[model samples]
Target chain A: MSRLFRLYEKKRGGRRTGSKTVGSFGEALFFGIFFVVGCGTMAYMLVALAWPEWRANRQFEETTCVLVGKRVGSKETAEGEPVQFRPEFALKYEAAGRAREADGVYDVTNLYSSDEAGVKSVIEQFEVGKKYPCWYDPLDPQRVVLVRGYSLWLYVSLLIPLSFIVIGGGRMIYELAHWNASEERRSVLDSAAAVDWFEAEAGERHFPNVPDGSNQTNSPGTKLAYRLPISATFGWTLFAAMAACILWNALVAGFVVMVVRDIALGEPDWVMALTLLPFAAGGVWLIVYFSRQILVATGVGPTRLEISDHPLVPGMPYEVFLSQAGRLNMRSLEVWLACDERATYHQGTDTRTEIRRVYEYRCFVREDFEIPQGLPFESRCQVQVPEGAMHSFLAIYNEVSWKLIVRGHVKGRPKFEREFQIVVHPALAGQLVS
Target chain B: MMDPRLSLMLDEPQRTFRPGELLAGQFFLEGVRPEEIRAVEVSVLWHTEGKGDEDMAVHFFERIDPDLDDVVDLRQPRRLSTVLPNSPLSYHGQIVKIRWCVRVRAFFWHGKELAAEVPFQLGAVPRPQEAPV
Candidate 1:
């Protein structure tokens, strides 16, 4: 029985303590969201491309015109002069009462004449015989033009915004999957250990804290573990938003296509709901997203540090003190000093120290040695602190400032940097000048 | 040695024409180099100041010679006169002298090489009158 139990323990040990099933589910969910959003965006673009043709075929008619006359001279002067003249073929159409009413009455009268003399003058100036392309509805043969073509650029321009939605949605889904998988594994391990007699024999079995399991090294809960759900929520919200946007775009395209088809079929007066509704909604969403991001960035509290008031001369031992001032604690903090090229360090005195202040989430301690005669009065010194650490140093040295560098991942969010300057007083200058 | 360039002096008709009226002018070209010139083509080009350091306008070529000789190398000043726009110019009965300059180019070797160009302003012409109703 002892040997059999040993074999069983070995076999159980080989099995991963975490739940593989949960991890897989999380990964599948992530990939599913990514695929749906990406494909939807591509479909929206393709629908937009076909929209113009759908509109054109539904309303306008094809017609023909003969070159009457050329628009001569500069664009400015060509207006008063007959820009184009109706050819003889157009005369036949005019005789047959086929001339369409010119669209803008005022511009037509001011720019082109309607009288026979004007027509004759235009025809005389015409290259005599040239065929021009025009479009008109068969029902109303009067509408015609010297130029006709569909502008394809309108539909092509939709790709830019669609691409952004796809990229942002894909990245969010990836992060969500990673968080979900890790959470599942953690729960599985906790359950497996709880079932083991040896682990449960003690009042509380203490397992090595998994990386990103919980904030407290001693406790089972950690900030990293809690952040997984938060990340998932954010990812799902973004995915839903992207899906809605794609649907809104597709609906708008369909509506435009329907309206165009109606107009082409000669239902010119058919009124459809203004398609601008979706565009307006999209604009509002963009504004909200931007404002939310800005608010989050500003609400992350400032970094604070403490510094001792003393002259830091080259080749001298100066005790530069540091501490945090804000409620938030930082993961890492650092300081760097630079002096003139001719400066030299004192033997065994040039050293850098980093101290993770115990129990001080908002505070840390560090000590650095000043190279003897290493820095001159005119030289520059720089102090750098990572994001989330509060600095009291910016207040002490009037000339020196705290510059925040990289803010590490906390809630799957990026780090930010800020700089503050401290001033050195005239009284303290003499100590360092010597 | 004289440079192979042409200089011109233009004089406009004493009156201006209406909006659709055509204006006429006389332009004379004098050769700086004593070289033979085959044929001379006159054109009325519009002129305007461009944004940068240049001028912008169009040149409307109007042939004055109905029968331009194949070649006539000239060492002395020559004179020819004809209508402003004929079949070759093809800009007849149209306004060509709005803010205009008369440019004359001497063609040589069956129109292979242009010997010289002479440009001169035609002071504003009288606007054409409306025919009595």
Candidate 2:
């Protein structure tokens, strides 16, 4: 029995420990929140998208009538004579029930009459007939539309929300995968460390012993075995929610297009409401889903790199310590030096493309860097510090906080690291006189 | 000697308008105090810089009768506008103050065989119709 137990123990010990066991609970929770939020957001967007149409229609119904008018002159040029231009009509109409009267009546003229030729030529390319179509409410007859079935703004409005969903969804997925990998790695490291300490203690070797109560392993598997499944479920749920949002947005857009087409074709009012209802519902769903996700998944914090001091001197190098406070990790870090303020700093695929007129340097910190020998206090250090500090002791300062940009895996999980500032005082020039 | 002076000024020069609208302001005569003012003619002119050496000029002339009311006629004015040679109308609104303006492009020039181009501005305003009650 003893031999079998020892063999079993040996086999278990040989097995790689500290392999990260992703707590599905966190992931599941994250995804659940994400899914709900994404769907809610999508639904909200759908509603928002439909709002303008609804509002406009409501206003149309409330208002008495629309004004209608047309340009009267012939746009075409005559054979031999110069184009006989007809001046535009200027008419004034006042709103009823307003106490104050309008100041004065005037005739408006087009200053760029010469550019009419250019405008006409451009319009001709679109195969638009010479007859400019217009509309006004039948009841009021004063409100008007200059060109019928012509709306270029709709395309832009539709594209904005669609773009947001696509980009946001893609980012969320990438984050999930990255987060899973990181968690796995962390678990593996923790388990390995625990096993190593256990073996060292059993051997009773003189190698410095782990301090009492200070040797606790940071392992999710040991702490919460059920977390993985929960996390996975949550993650999948969130993904589904996000997908739903995108789908809802698409549906709303399609509905809007259809409604607009119907209106242009002079469709019945009954058909308009029936066609628009589904879009409105989808929009409402998106809002609910997004709001829920945002509320529940608010725990995801930011990545912060804290530096102990500023204005690192020429002779002294500061020690930079790195750790994580939130639910994420920084996978890469870098440091750079540049004298010009406009120097571009690129990390991975991201580019800082702006003209900054001042002293600047770019440092990439995926993890952290600690210089045992302090950084030298010199002019190079001045590149990172303000001009006032240039004359004082050397300081290493960051212009912007460490951005919580997740390269891969888990969204909204906060990761934090800190760096210490080491100031090197200037060397004395001569002996002191007391 | 009469100093061969030329000047221009507009009463209430700035005003706003809606689409298909017309603006009217009065031109004033200042620093003239001349012995005998013969004929005051105001020419509505459009000026732009010409390529290289030649300065381009296009103008329409209106004889301002000081005795007559400053009423602007949009459709038909007194005469076909003409551009003057050699002098090219020495009064740009920049220097002289001897002319008065009226509705759109009516100006007052008072001198013998003398012609002056007066500056006038016309603008178009867009009219968006409001929903009826």
**Interface C-alpha root-mean-square deviation, candidates in order:** 41.8, 36.1
- Candidate 2 residue A380 C-alpha distance from true site, Å: 20
Fnat per candidate, as a fraction, reads: 0.00, 0.00
Candidate 1 per-residue lDDT, tens place, B10-81, comes to 333443222223444443334433234445565544332211111212224544332465333344444433
Cα lDDT, model 1, residue A319: 28
- Best-fitting candidate, scored by lDDT: 1
- Candidate 1 off by > 4 Å: A1-31, A47-132, A135-161, A172-434, B1-133
Show where candidate 2 strays beyond 4 Å.
A1-300, A312-316, A329-434, B1-133
The lDDT for every candidate, in the order shown, is 0.35, 0.33
How high is each candidate's TM-score? 0.18, 0.17
User: What value does DockQ give for candidate 2?
Assistant: 0.00
Q: Candidate 1 docking: what grade?
A: incorrect
